[model samples]
Target: MTTTAAPEARPAERRTAPAAPPPVRRRRRRGDALGRTGPSKYLAHAGVWLYVLLLAAPLYYLVISAFKRNTDIFNQPFSPFTPLTFDNFGLAFSQASLGTAMLNSVYVTLGAELVTLLLAIPASYALARSKGAVGRMVERVFALGFLIPGFAALVPTVLLSISLGLFHTREFLILFLPASALPLTVILLTQAMRAVPAELEESAVLDGAGPLRVLWSVYVPLSVPTLTVVAILNFLSFWNEYFFSLVIIGPDAALRTAQVALPTLSIANAAQYGVLAAGIIITLVPAYLVYAVFADKMESAVLAGALKG
Candidate 1:
């Protein structure tokens, strides 16, 4: 009887409440200040646009000035699209010997790039693959060459050219240009070559291939994209080379490169902005064309190199 009475007792003991859930904490948003875009992000974007505009302004001026008469350029320097004229380009081509200078630039650039690649590839490969003290020493020496300004070498280079009777000669220009450009080329190509997998070389060798054979069959083929980048860089350097061309070739106006000729055309006492702009446009074309042709491959190669590193 007492047990039956106890069973009916106390509602407090009969039921229990379910547990409450833990509070949900929200994640903080990145690049946001008080749930809005940060000022730094806006500033960064603005700065990028500003930099782009800064870069484009000069090119815009050059194009506008190229089309304009001298008076228009002076009066309204910022105007977009002036009355177009082939006259400046024509004068640049004919009187300035810009056509010949362009041809000379092309010839010298091509020759120098070819020679630079020919020498740089093997040297880079050896430096990349070797592990000995001699290889380390050689690499160190090559790197040091970058420290010496090109101008510092000019006096000795000219003296040596004169002794070799190479002054004012195209052959001399070709040889000297490549020599001057080699250090940079080697540095770039070696860095690229080092990114290549050692397994590739090992596999080639295991297949009974020699070093040269492996280089030709495996390394060179894989490294084409890198080589293209190096070639482009070397071509640009040789194309824009001025001081050496100015001094070594020395007022042999006919032998001057496009770079050398451009400044020469500027009637220093009185600037011919139109003619100068045309020459600049002409010089820009080749580099632009080369980049356009190999842009995808070059980008891929550069990305790959970065990722490998």
Candidate 2:
């Protein structure tokens, strides 16, 4: 008892909790340095908004015009957002024979895309896997297809169609579109296929896969993104192809594509801006739909291709 009371226990040292290591101010990365400044950030936002407005302007006009009367379209061109009517769409559908025309467009577009892929895939695979200078030379030859102006080839195409006795037939479009699309399609696919590892092909071959099997099993699956990109591009090009469809398919309402049929709406009602706009909008839907379905894939494909390049 005497020992316990011998000395007054010193007051226990008061512990101060460590100040939370100064709320970690993470060092800004060099890539993000430009985004930190207020002025630069605001300027970037302003530029983006300006660009968006520029792009949206025409679309806004198209949509507004589609619902307005011709007089309204002209007089109040960019005013009053009321008094909308769906009459123009009816006029467009009836006058343009849009129902049949859209069907024709769909048929031709899908057919052309299929034919293009059938030819382009094999050609691309060959070129991609070729080791000799001959492949490079052939690819350069294919590139020359771009040099031949589309307008310049129109005459030949017309004559070729006539010579084959396939003039004014949808079948001819199936044949022709693939020819036109082949150069770009083959080039893109070749590049994409080249990006596929040689090991995959070798493994495929060891598994008793032939060239065609290897292409189908190895290359095609890996190149889906690029294939999608090519498909979308070709679809749009073939869809909006007014000049070719008009010339090749002829003005026959039974055969002409939507693009060709759309102008007929204008002919029937020269001053009906709404009808014309409606027809254009109708023609645009399929393209928009295709893009919407595949937009994300398209973006990734483009980024991948760019990085590979």
Candidate 3:
């Protein structure tokens, strides 16, 4: 301290060193050469719209024709629009027993979905949690059912129904349709259930929850989106089912479903385009209503199913 005083600090030296330069963010402006859409993007958009138009064209025709007479439909086959008439609907409902058929379809589709969910949820949960020889075999069997066409089961199902005195009845279809839909439901739900974290179940168990309680409280909540998907899919298939209804509930106006009943209108009308169009619209309503209500949830379920944690 006695030798010399320290040199006085310079103003530049006293200032803090400039803070490290902020991270450089290179933001590309829109409409820049690299930001412009590619030819492939346009082509993909074109293809998608084309496919949509192709599908929508038939539906447009169906609606327009539904209000037109058979003569008008055939005579003006390319007519893009027409005066609206509801007589065709009356004709369809009256002659086809379509009213009753609609009710029957509601019963079958709802009953089948309910039964499938009840059976599939528990079965899928068990299968997803198990990893033994028996589980593998059972899973394989369910997978095999997916590959086995419904046509193959038709005869056996009818035979069983006849034997058990359950044929030609809604009760028979309620049971049989669910059984037919079960394997696919189980497969979808089993995969979805696997997506639920095991830790949730363990935590529930520590809270003194039993297996069933844990399932209802934990895994079930997590798996709800996928379950809605299963219900919607099964509802669509069961509602549109034709062959099974045609054969199983055949010729029975009281028990027939919409698909089965609609054809009778065709046979009677020489397949009147107008009346059949009305019938088609009637047949599509339930499925469309379901999709409209659950479309967002269904899309979420699909995305969730595609990704695994």
- Kindly list the per-residue Cα lDDT of model 1 for residues 233-259, writing each as its tens digit: 667678888888888876666788888
lDDT winner, 1 or 2: 2
- The backbone clash count of each candidate, in order, is 0, 0, 0
**Candidate with more favorable, higher TM-score: 2 or 3:** 2
lDDT digits (tens) for residues 4-28 of candidate 2: 4323221111111122342232343
| Candidate 3, run of 10 with poorest lDDT | 2-11
Residue 50 lDDT, candidate 3, scale 0-100:
100
Query: What stretches of model 2 exceed 4 Å from their correct place?
Result: 1-55, 69-75, 297-309
Best prediction by lDDT: 2
Lowest lDDT 10-residue stretch of candidate 1: 10-19
For each candidate, what TM-score against the reference?
0.76, 0.79, 0.78
Best-matching candidate per TM-score: 2
lDDT (C-alpha) at residue 137 in model 1: 93
What lDDT is reached at residue 226 by model 3? 71
Local distance difference test, candidate 2 = 0.82
For model 2, name the residue pairs that clash. Answer: none
Report the Cα lDDT for residue 213, model 2: 92
